[model samples]
Target: MPSPTKETRTLSPLATLPATMQLHPPPSSGTHRTLRRLQSAHSLGAKAAAQPSLISQQRFQAQNQQQRQQFQRLQPIQQKPPSPARRHVSTARSPQRGRANSDAAPVPTTTQLAAMAMTATRRSALSKRSLAADSMSLERLLRDGPPNDDVEGALESARLKILDQGIRSDSDGMSSLRIYVWLILLNAPVLETDTYLSLIHRGPSPAYSKIRNDTFRTLTTDPLFRRRVSEASLIRLLNAVAWTLHDTREDRTREPSIASIASSSRQSLDQLSSRPGTGHSGYGSGQSHPSSPAAKNRARALTLTTEGSETSMAAESGTYVQGMNVLAAPFLYAARSEAEAFIAFHQLLTKELPGYIRGAMDGVHKGLALVDKVLAIVDPRLSLYLLSKNLTAEIYAFPSVLTLCACTPPLPEVLRLWDFLFAYGPHLNILCIVAQLVMIRTKIMDSPSPNKLLRSFPALQADQIKRTTLAIIKMIPDDVYAEIVVHAR
Candidate 1:
């Protein structure tokens, strides 16, 4: 066979080709189109697999766009930008942003609101206290006559002010007017510097050795007292008081006896009645008129009797006592000068608390007894508990009685308590003592040894003490309260 043209040439079929090996029947047109479609699909899948990140990025962008549209729909409407000419005009009219929305401040939290309220309350209270202190100035009250010339009314007003609004003090707790108020309350007369100096020049008293021994110990622990008052000043004041007391004792001793005066007067009256003209018609008749010699003599005898009783009482009181130092400390601390302190101290010893300094300290003993009695009545359970433990006011309340609670610490609080005591009556100190016992009754009862607990009292709190004292006053019987009043005297 000759080779045919390229398009028409056909090689001779291999002889008897196996049916399995025969050339595949020419593919049908439908099958060929199906195969072409499958090829195109496979090619597209391969392209996507080759660059997956690009496809993923495109899908992610589509999702983000949808989210942005949703978010924009929820946003507040925004104003359009102003025209350039309008903006220029607006800027010229107003340099700063308007504050029309300034009133809509953010709401404060609960704690912030509470803190603001507390600050405002504190300011209001401080203002009220300042005004009250100024209005109740004791110096001003003394300089300007009392309103309506009511001295007692003015004093009451001052006391109420002291109670409601405490006296204003400097940072050191010193009050300029406290001494003056104390002088007025104590009725201490003004003394010349010369008088105090004269007493100082007279050298130490008979009690000087004893006074010296105590001088170093007076308020030894109180920094304020030590800073303000010196040992020499205390010595001078105490020595002056001792001299006054010594002179008083000597004067009392020199006084004529009532019995002698009475006997002498009786003898004179007898002789006068024995006279001829004065016999039956005069003193002997016992019908003498008020102006008659017999009546005058009798009146004089009665006066002597009254004076004798008073003298005997004075004689019982000693010139100096162990606790007088403590008693004088507050006066010294409060006074502006030694002379002032001297006046107050002398007055207190001779007038207000003479009984307390008696040779036996009978008044202190009485005060202690009154404390027990008052406690027994006011709080029977506590009183019974104490009694069972062999605890008596005598054991626990001696210094309190002797010093008028000046033995307590925190001199400022003592000063405040003194204000109340001097204003009302020093006798109320018994009530105050009882009030302290009542205040700690629960603690005392709980303790196994109350004596140890009461050995030294807790620090003074003037307000709480006063309130408790007032409450105790209401509960006590009248007789016991009266005893409390006079026991100190």
Candidate 2:
């Protein structure tokens, strides 16, 4: 007991303690294994918690990417309407990297692709005289008797025949007869080359500035128009017409004796504008509008001569507007010479549809309104839907009405439509406008933004428009048709 060793003393104390209270260390291998198991379990729990969030984040990114891609697909390219020379461009989908999965849906065919492929029957030129010969035939029929004879019966017969068979086909080349046919329908007097030559020699027109600005841009996208038509020719033709109008007005103002003629003409103008039947009953219908009213008024009232004058008459008829160049393009394309084109274009503005190109373009505005009215009549449901979205004719049909639907592409189709217009009545254009709305009524009603559909109307299906137009015409009342006659003039 005296001064016992430390080990012995510690052993003596543990012997006094209960065996259960004693401490002992486990084997190193066992302790390490237990710690490893705990660490593995904790890590497994952490991974399980993070997996859901990671998967959700990836799914959201994929969804966002898909929406972006869909938006890109829906965005339309900024382009003029489709042209005849432009063939169908395939929209077949190429396999995208992330999107090519087993769950992805297959691509579907579009109605538009089918429509684009279905072009109207194109006419071939049998000979250069085909169009002119047809015109001559029509002339003989109309002039079968005296000039003052009741040619209405004969005129109606000829129109029906031409409408059934469009002014010669434009199969491979331009139809030489289209110009003559257009001139005949317009009742424009035949002119010698000297008339146009004289006008050109007179130098720049009072509207030269506006004409020059628009000439280069006319139908720039159409291959035929761009390649075949020279800017110089268009400028010259428009300038000459402007000069003729200016010269005529200046000549009229200078002669006091013509004052009485002018007064009577103005009175007649007031009457024609107010009374539909008294005016030209058919626009582009091959029937002549009395010259005393339209011609005299244009000459006397629209004194838009030299230097863009601000007089009411000058403002009404003075400088060129935005779409005149486009309006003149079809004329130049069909005419053999500037003289022929000049006569047609001049008569169109002054006699055929004076209100269209006037300073205010009131006739164009009226045409737009009539388009809306006609649509509402033909398809009330579609019209109401469009009206609800504020998509009126002015927003979409302005160019079509202003250019007689020539503003849109597939030049061949436009030429065909013009054939119908010339043979029947440009007033039929209103019916044509209604037909357009009817053709795609479903798509328009389904669209969230119909303006996009209207901004540039769907490509011209000449046959479809003509067929639909003819059917619509039969349904229209005589009174409404009369209103359409005067709507643009």
Candidate 3:
């Protein structure tokens, strides 16, 4: 039997199996045997699906054991709760310090009361005089107010803290506490999920799906924990994630970040994870393949469609996507693959959409369609977003994920919608985007009309574009969401 050529890899299973298919050749004996074996293995998959190859299982077990050991090693240095004796000891020390803390006596004054009053009055008047000045005047005025040698030190600290916060926001891994809380959270009889244990013990593995799915069943058992992780809170979490993804170039480049709208978030170092071995996980250490049959099918239907990464995103929008490319490149490629899957999902949703949803998300659908065309050359269903309409000229949907939430008005509400989009399927997120557009339709339409300043009103950054998109989506009836819940996503 002749060896199969590279072209064979290009055809899909259904396409290749049919006599009408011409791209792939009839399988040679060796190729035929390979196909038969693949079919046989696939048939046996349901039985062994819960398990894996002995090699993989053993490796997983050993990895799990090592993770347990590492978790043990990582267990935080737990502080013992204060005992009564310790309280007494602290009490005993307080009075002795208090007695010593006071100054012994007052020194005699050198100046008169009138001079002191005059000095104080002059300084007050001078402060008022200085404030009513421009930059240069303010600079000179600041010099007159007080000695500022330590101001340099204070400024340096501020700079350092700012840099640290920036680092924290971008971190996807350990920046501060993740485990200390886990250790305590895990031991509480009614507080934690086995989900906490699995990550700590196994790191991260592709095999965690079953464990996580099982854990999901137990999530409601811990009422307090459930409340802590409510949809509202999860939306807050997504907001954090959106912030974490913040790139200065994208998020705050155009508009000033409204200080009033956003609270300053410092990186929390005092996490429950201050204690070691508390909550970290080893699951997801292994690579993740696409889970659904469609994903697998998509893999076979390979394309050069690059995943939507900051770079590719920037390229599409004519901006330089910041950050290290290596870390982001793989994900971008994955996004391209994700986009392909999204288009296929979009196809399914289009077939199933209720009349209203189909009508409302027209532009969003158009965007998805555009995404499909862009990725069609590579493969469709890469990293497509069914973006809700952004009608305000003040802000269009910001390009990168970092900038997306930053540009929205009802940001907290917005991020909650984004959370499930990424959480479920990568490409299937188009539905959530569409849903949000519908949700915000009225707010957008009521906002001031788009600036007609631009020659092309329907441009990407058009003022009413988002609202128009939303209005379009508003037409989708609730019944359309059934498809979203069951299949679209």
Candidate 4:
């Protein structure tokens, strides 16, 4: 179909018509607007067409002017000749600096470039590996978590049994007495443990001769207990310490079960004393000495004697304080290759899983509040530590409560907490420290500010520590998990 077109009219007098005119009726308002638009567009087209011509003319004028200016300037130079000295000076200076080796010809092979590139690549890789090795080392225990699958299951079972046994209606479980016993046993020398074990087998007694006799026999049977400690070595010698400190035969000399062992040890001690004894640095060079008896007594006194309750333990069962002290140098050394594995574990637990699903997340405001609360009340020492250490986000992301401080303090305190961590891992141990600290806070709150609190905690007992740590782990709600960014690691 053909398109429709309306008639056109102009406001000019010739375009206008008399009142009776009909051949082309006057245009409507719509047609007038269309004509006005067309007229304006035509005018715009003319202006656009004129711009290029103007520009071309300007260029032509510019070209002519530039040629004239160049001709005028070059006339003087053309009239003169270059000096010989100036030519020589230019040639000599430019060529000397630009030449390669002054004798060798140019032209590098593609193969040579490829070989050079390969060498550069290899050097870069080697440098990267070296830097990685130095900045961060491999610590397997921290990286790998507990190796024993059985240990993991055992800990869970132990947790259940403890919770069932000790938890009151309103609360979670108390600390496991068995673990407390075990930790103390772990810390004490094995020889002493054996002696004490034997003594405990017998009824309690204070008989000097009888006790000495029992202690002597126990040491003979337990040949593993006599090894010396390596001061320079990095890993924990738990079994070694357990073997040495646990020689308690003297504690129960009269008891029937290990009575003979004590009698033998005592007899041996007396014989050595009577002989004026000898000194031994274990590499076996020593001379019989006059003061041997007194020295031997002092040596014997050093053994850990857990007699009556197996209950007498170190004053402190460290959680954050000790971990806060040592952070985790010993365990990472012991479990040298697995440190990153723990960091990864923390990253997952504390980061990926949002707590909102659990309906406990209080959004950003509430989340920040809880974080502040934990930092403020959980351990005042942590703030001082955070301030002093200038903890980075990477550090706070550390899932373990101890983070860097676990191994910071004295040997005894660090080991006690480590025994718990090695036995338990981050989940229970870190949580319980918080819960336990909260429980005992009233007692120790006023003694020191955050910095001084560091000193007060190392003296805590094993049992008290266990109970409180468990409570915290069992009670922390799923909601707040979002706040702990370290868990994702």
Please report the candidate that would top TM-score against the real structure: 1
- After the best TM-score superposition of candidate 3, give how far the Cα of residue 221 lies from its true spot, in angstroms: 38
Candidate 4 global lDDT: 0.28
What does candidate 3 score on TM? 0.18
Best by lDDT: 1
TM-score of each: 0.59, 0.59, 0.18, 0.25
Predicted candidate 2 versus true structure: per-residue lDDT over 1-489, tens digit per residue: 011111111111112212332112223544444443333333332234433233343343354445435433432222222222222222222333332233222221234223322211000001111222334455454334212332333343344445555566556338766776666566555465665676678787768876776677778778887777899999998887776566555554422222233344343112211110100111121111223365345334323334446644545455455567777888888778877777778867776677776655677767777777878777788889988986777566756776788777777788888776765556667778888788788889899998776666677877777766654543455457567877766
Taken over the whole model, the C-alpha lDDT of each candidate is 0.57, 0.55, 0.24, 0.28
lDDT string, candidate 4, 14-86, tens digits: 2222233212222354543443343333233323443333333334435444543543442211211112211
Instruction: Name the lDDT value of residue 238 in candidate 3.
Output: 22
How should the candidates be ordered by lDDT, best one leading? 1, 2, 4, 3
Better of 3 and 4 by lDDT: 4
lDDT assessment of candidate 2 = 0.55
* Model 1 TM-score (2 dp): 0.59
RMSD of each: 42.2, 33.2, 33.4, 35.0
- Candidate 3 residue lDDT tens string, 57-156: 2343354445435423422222222222111110011111212212221111223223333323322211121112212221232233212333222222
Report the candidate with higher TM-score, 2 versus 3. Answer: 2
**lDDT of model 4, residue 16:** 23
Residue 14 C-alpha lDDT in model 3: 17
